[model samples]
Target chain A: MLGAPTPVLSIGSGSAYANDRLAPAVAMADSGRVSVMGFDCLAERTMALAQIRRRQDPSAGQDERIGALVPLLRGYLSRGGKVVGNFGAANPDAAYEEFAARLRKVGLLGVRIGVIRGDDVHDLVTRLDCALPELGTTVGALGDRIVSANAYIGAAPIVDCLREDAQIVLGGRLADPSLFVGPICHELGWDLTDWDRVGHATMVGHLLECGVHSTGGNFEDPPYRLVPDPHNLGYPLADVDDGSVVVTKLPGTGGAVDELTMKTQLYYEIHDPARYLTPDVTADFTGVTIEDLGDNRVRLSGARGREWPSHLKVLVGVDQGWKAVGEMSYGGPGCADRARRAEEIVRARLDAFGSDIDDLRVDLQGVGSLFGDRLVGGEPTEVRLRLAVRTPNLEAARAAVHEVELLYFGPAGGGGATGSVVPALGVTPAYVPREQVRLETEVLET
Target chain B: MKLREMAYSRSGDKGDVSNICVFVYDQADYPTLVEQLTADVVREHFGALVQGTVVRYELPNVHGLNFVLDRALGGGVSMTLRVDPHGKAFQSLILDIDLPGGRR
Candidate 1:
């Protein structure tokens, strides 16, 4: 007996931001209309960092913010509002155990928590006989340097867990949109093979996946399309039934939801409008249309879908050596000139030291750093000199940082000299046959 | 007039590629945007920041043109030494393009 027209709310969007999203989640839950609340906390770099944490501590790797979020949602859980999230970045089992303990501590007992694992294919990645389409290299060529490899699993496992009466679902390295799609599929009982319905649902998931983005958080026309009470911005919600969705937010909350806002989010991070790939289906947004339904609500429809791809996209994190960046600001007249001199001095120092830096860059931040060789008009009163270097050896990276620190003593008006040397992790995109990876789901009770 | 007077833009990045979408507020401005905003014009506008090819995709339903710049962001956010590694600020550059209509 699933809710036919399920109202899904997106609570948290990015990776562990400081804002208190729990308050809005509580508000949406108190309405007694939301059947599911999904949190998307995993990003490309965030997953890579989670993998590093997992290597350091076996029990860790989940989003730390989940520890604080679930306890606050106990009231909602008691009200029968379900939760699905990818806060279990690299360790779903460990995250589920920790979440269950927190739930019991808060006196919210007997809550069934479902954990979805087996997305990680670090060991099996090297054995795959396939070449990365992006880099044109075989998986075997990557060899032992691959630290973490996880496929973007879809919504089927999540729907499966919800069918078993699990109040909460946790997954690791799953596609972000699937966090929203799972609840939709479970409530609607839409077949995975139904490309049209799946695609429409996926479009809804994408609109709500970023939480506040669709609700005017990062809207383009700012002052014209004002978002009232933006500091306390409200998250987005989708009321869905069949294949249609109405995108809206909690009533009387901050942020505006309209056609412009929805349009911007629709094209966000999307390369091709016709072939937006996900584990569930190949969503086609070309024919999609949006209509303002009034009062911060818009109707989205006509999203078609094709068959799912034969291979799953896997993100692999590899150690790419060490990188160091140092910066110092110069103020008052002739600041750009002073910054240029500082850069020259640092480059001369590195050159004199016989440094074997792989990629070295020096730029005046206030002048022409972002545009590269393209110079902007006029001079600035203040400029910051940024020098960055990548080296195979940590000591060399530190030496490069030291060179920028030396700028304070040599160059005039040089201040705020600071820098950091950290191990660099580069992401390599790969593909693996869908059958090569297995998705496992387990229900745990408190 | 500047392009911002007629359109709004948003930029995003994937690997080393950066895509900027310029959406016209008025439907009538779509043809003008398509005519004035070509791949060559975008390449010249971005200059050296984009070392590779620039391809444009038009979405008539939304009155939008998406410009994909390759080899941008130096080498993507994670590896690039750029201050704006995500290329989030690049939208303003595209919006600053001059228009023939003069402040529509």
Candidate 2:
């Protein structure tokens, strides 16, 4: 806990949904109340896709959102609002170079940028002594098919970068919540061993990490329609000091930040409430409490934490051949029956070709496609038949599309046929000793 | 009354596991939620979608119950061919469950 509290604002949440977040973030930064702004743009497979992009072109591994977001944040950067994020994805060095160049082009030169590295442990994965606990397989089994492997690093290096007076910090594959936690630790001077404070701050990071989710983005039960100005939903912010954090959004922005929204975001993607594992510490959210302070403000407290883990969690992406999908709709009377016949015909034709399909699924769109064969009864005037398949080779994957196309020739009424095939990237989790990975920071100036 | 009338929910996925959180509107209904919404009930409610075990974590202070369903979401967000790849829609699915004796 610090003598004075510091406010950290979260700009972007998920990778794909981050672009729309800049407006609200800039709006908040303009108020001059936030000390630091953090952006969490990397998901489990984001680095895998980024690595593929880098393989194609040596300088293409950075999160593309940075290019658009930097210009929008130029005013904030000039006004002394610090920034930190995992938008570096698979290549922090390349991302830093690109960002510096973009800044210079916009005449916002001389901004100090820090790049944190060493999250990529692709070379050490096979030699590591640990194994993937979930799959019951050793790292050696992943072989040469592994494209990218990164350990989820904590906030120490990020704090070190901040201490060096870096205006912007770019990181590769750091833990999502650490983006926010790093700033809090740097500002409040909280020790890593302060379990209670760290735990309380981690909850604040988790709530703000998803941006609008804590501010009414994907909130459905209360029905988003009731949320004020749902179209212009605000991003989340945390006013943290003395281990106590109050969550709220920009004052005039459109969104609700009550207890319901906070609770929903608290449990999002967490496996165990008692033991929420991370590189920094094993946070226990079970003892946590939330108080609705009215308006859009909620207060969170009582989050307890234990010691940090000996091993860091890593995500490994392996090339898994190709996947193909095709969809067509059947309408008018007996649409469901016609859709079923179309599926059977496509399955029989694909089987006749003897294609080496690893997995094949035929689903009736308006029926039970999402739940798989659990159809609730109702007569539908139209039904779309969707065929999806995965195969070890592109030839087999393409054969699935060919079979679905034949439906137009024989099926009674099959229209709107669309298909696509792309290489699949499969992800698996592994654990590696913390000592095996070294985190280093580099400062670059425009 | 439907569970949606009493509670609100939010869900997300990590690998093949999907977690859905149900937060009752009133703190007084926390006990009823804990007793009625069990692992077995959620596993049965999800049916074939959940191939493995279902674990429920209770947070009495927040009046929230988190249901972690294993082997759900077809495969996961990146690998799944389903329309709702991240299983974000599952929150509404679970919230639609029927509750006995109406509001607490």
User: Whose DockQ is greatest here?
Assistant: 2
Mind giving the per-residue lDDT tens digits that candidate 2 earns over A94-204? 889888988887789889998999998888786773476555666677676677788899888888898888988998887878887788878887887887777776887
lDDT of 2 at B72: 89
True contacts kept of 2: 0.62
lDDT of 2 at A60: 75
Model 1 - which docking category? medium
Residue A154 error, candidate 2, Å:
1.1
> Lowest summed lDDT over 10 consecutive residues: which window, candidate 2 chain A?
A9-18
Which digits, one per residue and each the tens of the lDDT, describe model 1 over residues A1-446? 76554544333232222233667766776666577877777766677778778878989988787778777777778887788888788888888988988998899999999999989887667776456554557667767656778888999899989989998999998787888778787787788888888898889889878777787776636554577788767777878866577888877888888888888888877777888889889999988888899998888888999998888888777766788999999999888888888878888778843656778888888788777655467868888899988777788899888888888786788999999998776666677888878888989889
Interface DockQ of each model: 0.59, 0.67
What is each predicted model's overall lDDT from 0 to 1?
Answer: 0.79, 0.79
The regions of model 1 sitting more than 4 angstroms off are A1-23, A129-138, A220-225, A352-356, B100-104
Worst 10 residues of 1 chain A by lDDT: A11-20
